[model samples]
Target: MRANLCSLTFLLALTLQITYTTSKHLAERPSFLNPCDYNGANFDKCFADNFQLLFSHWHDGVPGLKSLGSLDPLSIKRIKIQQDSGATLNIVAELENMLAYNASKAIVKKATLDKSNFEVDATLELPALYAEGNYKVKGTVLGLNINGAGKCNLEAARIRLNFHLATKLRDEGDLTFSDIVSLKAKILEIGDFHIDVQNLFGGQRDLEATANDLFNQNWRELFGILSPTLEQTLELVLKDRFTKIYAYVPATYFISNMPRASEFYG
Candidate 1:
């Protein structure tokens, strides 16, 4: 009798263990459908709308900018701009001074959007771009410190970004819904960031003359070397803004409809 009782107790415990494990596993399973499917919501419009709404909030800096972290006073310990063979100049630069770039307005000139691709032609009016830095040059160029500050402007800047829809289940209390898993935005064109820096050599005639020769005579060389840093700075600014937006907005908000899939996928 005791043996039969022990056997029955073991069987009951095993049954409970199996039931608990299965239930937990099922509960953890995601409930949303793949976002890229034909049956899923119209992601093209979703992306377009989000982008438009995003621009509206750009005046104050990307929505939720504070949460992402500071993009201001971007640090550039040192950056080198190289030239191609037979190029007139090569330069190494440093921003000992901090840069303050404030965009007063942002307008999307044009945009192409779909489930798989995205692109935009936009302009950001940076009413203020203060520069405090120095540039040292080598290779067919004047070697000296260029120190100054002035107005910076970026006009008709074009950006091309492509990404696919990703979905994940977000649990809030007793409710759960799909959310954007992750995304990446690539800047095809950093556009033109021109700095009208003064005092190339603190009014030193010889150095200033060489600087003029390098810049005026070999403008392409100067642009080639300087453009990368400008591009990277712009990229960081844009990425931070988008990241903040992504955190507050749900994936479904960008889509026209949500379709349920038997299996969950990105």
Candidate 2:
């Protein structure tokens, strides 16, 4: 949920690009983030709603925050994956242009926030998520030997992710806490990826054709075995970018005035 919305903030940092067109600037101290208070009635829904609103307006970068730029062609210096199968399957890929489409169309269906703890759990759905990238890859998977670089395209038709992510909070007291975002996301499902990777085996016509056939035929199993590596890879990407974006904003900016523990009991 939040993961889909994550494009614009840690959430944004993931997608990392913008300009806030609205007169209400995100830099307006207390911004839209304040109402996300923990003690506020229906605050969880409040947070979710706000996330969706902002996602819809993602093209407009937050005021007073440095633009992290667009999510399209998200760059990846490299991804190295090693899986234990009958024979080790290892893949190392470097992508300069990776397109993640329709990120702004993400819907945060539900969000539960613990502002004080800097935690959020949300369910996010995106109708269509399609990506294509130019890749240089070196890897071996299944019984096939794959070594080469080529073009890769992926169609993750519909994406549904349950995000359990936390921010490292710095307390400003009085229930206010700084965003201090350090993101670690747990993705429940990324949906099915209909994909194609070309030019493997250095164009060994026989092996290349066979590998392509195998990829199309055994994609499900491959993804199952590779999901962990994929998740870890995404986590690294998000964490690095999230930190870079948040670095410019003062920690206090994300502070939310939440009710103290005593309020609920007293």
Candidate 3:
């Protein structure tokens, strides 16, 4: 489950645009404000209940969840850069945009918890995630900076992921969630895109048109190069957060049957 949550966070970095709002259908009083009581008579039920509550809050984006808004289009203040040159030739590029994610659309396919292990699988289909902004660049072809502004939209058909988590009871009667046991995802279909940047590098219409044309032609390559790096970064961030949340969970909540620990499968 840690991997799953982290994957969602990573997706948010690429997309989350608005704060999560409570849903009438899923809304309810929180089952537990903190970790479950490991010593509760029904420790298994208590553990499952707590997991469900957290999952719902994450899916709906309640107040206390770690909200990473840096990549959100609205939160992006500005992106300014001054580059000198490059090999073969000199080039420059400056761009900006706003991004957002729809928590309401995040769908959980499966969630399972046993003893000290947890797992979750889910998918999300973003109708449209876009950035409405401008850009400026120079060097290489135009030999001079050209200024332009436009919009970029990404329509993702589906995003599917699976995550597994392991936990151990501590000497202090608390539980500690191990690092993600496994994290896997398949992001499919970014089928549509639009880019229109006007040429501002003097009256060289052909040069500007050429630059825009080249960019449009190779945007896919650019996305391909960047996606993997972003995914790894997100995985690390989620792992850290998961460990912290589980650190404070009382061990009793997971091992109420400590005497029979040898018989527990997870």
Candidate 4:
């Protein structure tokens, strides 16, 4: 009788062990048995990958600005970008005193990035010029930002931008010049800016000569002499005061294929 009782006890213990092991295995497995488990880790991974793919294509697929028609000489090119990954970028393209008459070209000279965000440094090259009114360099941003939270699966954040120009003095004379000249006032938003010309020609002969040449329709000659100076000035100003002039402008349009969700899991 005692032997039979011992056999029964062993059977009970084995049954309990099997039950415990099965329960633990189920717990370790993914809790995605139901369709409502869309909020699981698998979903997060899928969403993140899709977002990155979309952004990469947008950045590299868009045609360069050169495809666009002639840009105005008085305007500077500006680019701003934001990402859902908490990254922000800003880029400015300066004409570098390129002549309006020449077939000017702008290129991305250098790019800096912090993990996910990137900023491009650009320079404009123009043929020699003898005349100058106001020259412009065109800049644009071709990127997208996506933010997901709560019930909304995606949101485009804001990006702000502000641009300024400064010219070096060329002659030794007190000449009043305006830096913040408004060209197409309506084209830019409320905060666009221009150079502040206050007695710019007080003590520079070369600058004065170049300015005169620019105004006299000798744009080709002016470009050769002034382009270097303009490039230097732009580098200095951007390094010293870019943060102050920086603005956060929002994305203009959405470029994502992801479906908008009414709610997200944390």
lDDT per residue for candidate 1 within 141-259, as digits (tens), equals 43433553222222223323333334344544333344444443333443333333345555566765565555555444454454444555545445544544454444344443433
Q: Candidate 4 — which residues are off by over 4 angstroms?
A: 1-71, 75-104, 109-118, 123-130, 133-229, 235-266
lDDT of each: 0.38, 0.56, 0.42, 0.22
Q: How many clashing residue pairs are found in candidate 2?
A: 13
Model 1: which ten-residue window has the lowest total lDDT? Answer: 7-16
Q: Once superposed on the true structure, which residue ranges of model 3 sit more than 4 Å away at CA?
A: 1-56, 59-98, 110-127, 131-189, 195-222, 233-266
Give the TM-score comparing model 1 with the true structure, all chains together.
0.49
Q: Highest lDDT, which number?
A: 2
TM-score, candidate 4, is 0.19
How do all models score by TM-score? 0.49, 0.70, 0.43, 0.19
Candidate 2 lDDT tens digits, 1-266:
00111111111123344544333223345344444554567667767786565456543434455545544335453444433444435455555456666766878889776645657677778777777766676656766666777777777756776656665543333332334355555556655667777777666678777777777677777666666566666676655544444444433343246443344224
> Who wins the TM-score comparison?
2
RMSD values for the candidates in order, in angstroms, are 19.6, 7.8, 10.2, 32.4
Question: Global lDDT for candidate 2?
Answer: 0.56
RMSD of 4: 32.4
Model 2 error, position 14 (Å): 9.6
The C-alpha stretches of model 2 lying farther than 4 A from their native spots are 1-26, 29-38, 59-61, 82-84, 171-177, 201-210, 241-266
Clashing pairs in 3: 15-100, 16-101, 17-100, 17-101, 38-252, 38-253, 73-98, 73-99, 173-251, 174-251
